[model samples]
Target: MKQSALSYFQYPEMVLVPLILFFVFFMLLLFFITRPKNRELFKKMEKMPLEEEETNNESIE
Candidate 1:
């Protein structure tokens, strides 16, 4: 008898690959979130909304 390609993944072992990939991706996301960043850049971004057009022009000089 002939078997289809889908039959290969029916075994229980196929579950491990996806689980490991999910764990690795999750760990990478956590690592980036916990990592340190430039404080000055964040301060500039925070003040952007409050600054007016005149101050924006002066800063360009």
Candidate 2:
């Protein structure tokens, strides 16, 4: 019974440690990828012509 309890505790370190580490690593990766992409997209959006460009395109059509 004691050994079973010990194994139950040990199973998390053996299995869950790597799983947790992978989750953290992936979260960091997702943050880095999205942060820069979002900044770039926002910068581009800031310079975009609002209603003027659309009106010009409509007149040309």
Candidate 3:
């Protein structure tokens, strides 16, 4: 019983390290996204799809 109890966690099935790492990553991404310095980049990315479509249409037949 004693060994079983200790060994239960040896494999570490219920872990939270990954969750914390993911949360940290999400927060960092949010910080970068909200920063004013990145606004222009984001705006360009936002319009990229539309620009691509327009360019495709402008190609001669």
RMSD of each: 8.3, 8.9, 5.1
Candidate 1 overall lDDT versus native: 0.76
Per-residue lDDT tens digits of candidate 1, residues 1-61? 2367566647787799899999999999888656668556767888998787554445644
In order of appearance, the predictions have TM-scores of 0.46, 0.40, 0.58
Q: Could you give the candidate ranking by lDDT, starting with the highest?
A: 3, 2, 1
TM-score of 1: 0.46
Q: How large an RMSD does model 2 have? A: 8.9
How many residue-pair clashes does candidate 3 contain? 0
- Compared with the true structure, what per-residue lDDT tens digits does model 3 show for residues 1-56? 88888885574644678888889999999998899998899889988867745334
Which is superior by lDDT, 1 or 2? 2
User: How well does candidate 3 match the true structure in TM-score terms?
Assistant: 0.58
Quick one: best lDDT, which candidate? Answer: 3
Which pairs clash (backbone N, Cα, C closer than 3 Å) in model 3? none
Runs with alpha carbons beyond 4 Å of true place in candidate 2: 1-12, 37-61
